[model samples]
Target: MAMTHLQPDPSPYPADAFAAFELLSSAILVIDDDGLIRYANAPAEDLFEVSVRQLYAVQAGDLFRDGEQLRQSLEEARRHLFADKRQILEIDRLGREPTQVSVTVVALDGQPWPALIELREIEQQLKVDREERLLEQAQANRELLRNLAHEIKNPLGGLRGAAQLLEAELSDPALIEYTQVIIQEADRLQTLVDRLLVPHRAPRIVGDVNIHEVCERVRSLVLAEYPNGLRIVRDYDAAIPEFRGDKAQLIQAVLNVVRNAAEALSARIAAGDAEITLRTRVARQVTLAKQRFRLALELHVMDNGPGIPPELLDRIFHPLVSGREGGSGLGLTLTQTFVQQHEGVIECDSRPGLTDFRLLLPLP
Candidate 1:
């Protein structure tokens, strides 16, 4: 989907317009002609790490650590309608980490609002660049996997055929057993190759997808497998609207991640402390890939297990990199592919006891 620049709507204020502000990727602040904050979007709330109600109660100047510099910037913005200046400012909020953000201030022309301010994290810009690199790497990996599969696929048939013919010619049962083993191994490899190519061959079926429903489906499947001790918890925000996506593909993507968590929790499950939480929340002004959405869904799959091994953590999403024995590492690679197909991104954070896999997808 192409992202268009946001222009001032010519129509009179509509009820939906208010809700739409919550979806912007940039944090917006509407300053009254009197230099007070008249309005703030959801991203602004997140950027300042304050609730809208609390944000409204404080003076706009109090938001920045360098109040003097911000005050001067606001003054220049009001005087020059086309003014656009970039600055580094520290956010001020108690109990929250004091983080520096890259801020851009722009003066609005011929409107009730005097000026508007846009705030974005410096780290977020770095992440956007990193995601672009990861995307390029993923494309290369897909091509490599496809070519390698095809190479193995052709010889696989001949190898199996030769094994069958050898088994037929063997007179002694003991000699024939070796040929049978070769045939069985050949069939196993063929199945593995077929699995590797499934996502590329299947057409992406897009439709409206309710995130909680996908979570429920995965929860059911996991519970069926570890019914004794594993616990699946749901923390869903029912207000989140549905978005266009491939339901089956999403289900598969989410299931692969959750199932991996369940497998990792084998020890915890045996001790009755295993837990996986599926949490959903609404994110405002989130940028996925390069496009910014006014609203997006933040889904977190958190597990309590011996977290991902540090040595294998960085390469977890790379094709065929698995920490577990006898495991196929295609799960996260496929999950990342499915999410990217919907213009989304997946991130992971782990320590000794907690691991979180976050999926951010745009809302319709």
Candidate 2:
């Protein structure tokens, strides 16, 4: 949606015509020479979430949430308008929900008969500005993830080979154990690097597959990991249609997210508080990867734990960023890449109390 704003045009009224123009402006309001509101502008309607016609039906004193303060400000504006020729005041309008507005009062050049009061809504402007910043940040992250993953692939192979050679040359059994550790660690790194390259690899197979089957497979694996302490809940919409995708890739993608959630909840599981819910539903008029589809699958992995740490929340999908200690962090990155390959998108929302990872995939 296009953002809305209240902008005032340059006043055509001369200093003497201040009150007259104030009455005509979409923002200006005129009061009795005593500064009681007698007229308001169209824009004031939005500031109060009321009709402009209803504005005058109510007294200015009755319109302010803080009526006494508003009355005081009006009195001050009245005192200053005639003396200084103009004054700026902040007034809070009265209602079940009150609105704060900035009002400017200007005295007419020739007569003190009328005063001008301008109304504006600053809150709406701030909301739009914040959304713009968030969108820009999300875009930058996507680009960074793509570039960083590509850059890390070359050195990873050499490290893996060097560890393997050192493992073969070690003579002492105990010393060889250290080399084996290096080899194991290098192999783990190799797996992560391979995951980073998954998106670039072509899908080996594609066919119609039921999403629920995929979910169930992942659920079984997760349940096996936390058989005693964790609970895996399924909320499936059976009405959802099958989609064309690589079955194995989809399983791996879903498994990665579920496993990560299970890992994150390990402490909670030990305390008997871990609960992971896998929900599937169909979303209409869905958009993924900037393309709109008439219908899409919505998969949610919701966990009840301490939730993701605040500092790492935004970068959760980026390569090598993880909230978990001793985590390689490629799980989510590969999950995202696999989903994206199928023309899907993944989003996450995490706070102290709740964390939800959502995937939207286009249906066949």
Candidate 3:
């Protein structure tokens, strides 16, 4: 909404003054000199989760969770302390996630309404920005690792060969054991290098993939591994149409995510209370890999377990960044790579009791 539009009660300012703001995407609120809400545009009503008439004569600041900060801004507007000020704050919503918004408060010039407040939802914008950064960083990581893998391949093979030859020459059992350790460690590193290079391999086997099929495969695999004490629940969206993607790669991506969730529930597994859910839904007008798509498939792996540590959440998708003690940490990296190959994106959100991993792939 245009904060610059003259605003106030209908009696003081004509109805036409608020006409243009009704079409605005941003939310606009006009407060009288006493800091009471005189008018709210259509967008504002949506933002506040209330009607424009319901907001009338209400204290504008009281609408926010942290109203004191907004109240101070409104007070400043009434006294003409500053022309305009902007701040980021959260808007409280009942039974829903709080909306983070960029609020701009402008002191109107010689108008009946002294304060013009603009609320722009930044959550979606933040998600887009974050997704873009993630894409860029993942690309850089892939390039760096691919180059490193190529450089290490020859030396890694040589190290294993030298250890094997040294072991043959040593008749002494003790010396042979040392060479064996060297060979095993070299092989381990080689395996890791191979995993790092897997994403660089092109020509994925693409086909019309049923998302539920992929989830079922992963679910059965995970349930087999944790069968005694864990439960894998299916919440499939049957209406989701088949999309073109690499079936095997999609299965691997989903497997990695679900397996990770299972691993995280290790503690709960022993107690027989661990649960993992495979939920699928159809999303419309969603953005993935910095590109907007009309339709997309959303697969969520939700778990009730001890969540990922806060320190490692941001880097979980990076190569060699695992939360588990013995984890090689390439699962999520490869998962993201596979999803990105299909013009999709993966996101994670975790807290104390719940951890959710969502994969978004464009639908044909």
Candidate 4:
């Protein structure tokens, strides 16, 4: 059925009567008691990915995969028409890869039975909810890994001690050598277990942290590694506000990104052309981890080096994935986890001669 359009009659109300509807974050539609769509806002066009004229050609139920459920919701809204409450409904879209949407219905005055429908894309909300759950799961896994590592360590120590005792008592040279091999292998296993437990240890979160302090700490540490070859530069915006967070964890997070950049710049450093810049600024009206905020802190680490390999770029944040040979590959993953704990996001861009890592953190 073709959608019926409702052009408002000129009245004494303000010229911007539709302003509230246009500014709403939800996709909105106006309908009469007959259930014909009278109007839709910009968010409505975005929700359906169609122009107003195109959207007006179809019935409200036609947009949903499960039309019956939408009809039921509409009926429910009519039953409680003017109760001063919002009626929410969830529906699936009618398409190959169906998307979910949540809608709210409210009655509007100045008509016999005019109703307004507000729609929200639930797919993005679902993705955010999934990631939050994954983060929680990752934390749980870290705790389990820590306990398992400690349990393994106790047995490893006993095995190493037993091997040492056996090597001392053995009279045959070959048997004594085998016992020494057992002790060495146990020591190697212990080291691996310690590495596994590192992320699980609780960080001490205290003090009002000036992000510049964290950047400087990372800068000093990186320069200490390549004192003469690498040059660390700062481009700080002193007006950035202080945010409450775990100082040590923030330092480690910055250290990992900066140190990785320093490592990538090793060859250029040797050639006396290496440069790493640490920049900080305040971003307004930022969104991270699906939540929108009025302001945020943006810290960027940029380097002049052979950029990350294209093939390894996507998986850089995955555990055990690295661009450098012999790299343990846990640094970026740990950095992501730490920044996420602080309700922030880390993104990277790389080319042949330049690579940049940007961290966006909300101001608390």
Q: Point to the candidate with the largest lDDT.
A: 3
- The whole-model lDDT of each prediction reads 0.83, 0.68, 0.84, 0.76
Clashing pairs in 2: 63-93, 63-94, 64-93, 64-94, 65-93, 65-94
**What lDDT is obtained when candidate 3 is compared to the true structure?**
0.84
As for candidate 1, its clashing pairs are: 23-294, 23-295, 24-285, 24-294, 25-285
How well does candidate 2 match the true structure in TM-score terms? 0.56
User: What 10-residue stretch in candidate 2 is worst by lDDT?
Assistant: 1-10
Per-model TM-score, in order, reads 0.79, 0.56, 0.70, 0.63
Instruction: Please give the RMSD to the true structure for each candidate, in Å.
Output: 6.5, 11.3, 7.2, 9.3
Ranking by lDDT: 3, 1, 4, 2
lDDT of 1 at 335: 89
> On residues 243-354, what C-alpha lDDT tens digit does candidate 3 reach at each position?
8989999989999988888888888999999999899998765767666576788888999998999999999999888889899989999999998889999999999899
Candidate 3 residues lying further than 4 Å off, grouped into runs, are: 1-120
How many clashing residue pairs appear in each of the predictions shown? Answer: 5, 6, 1, 0
For residue 270, model 3's alpha carbon misses the true position, in angstroms, by 1.1
Most TM-score-accurate candidate: 1
- Give candidate 4's TM-score: 0.63
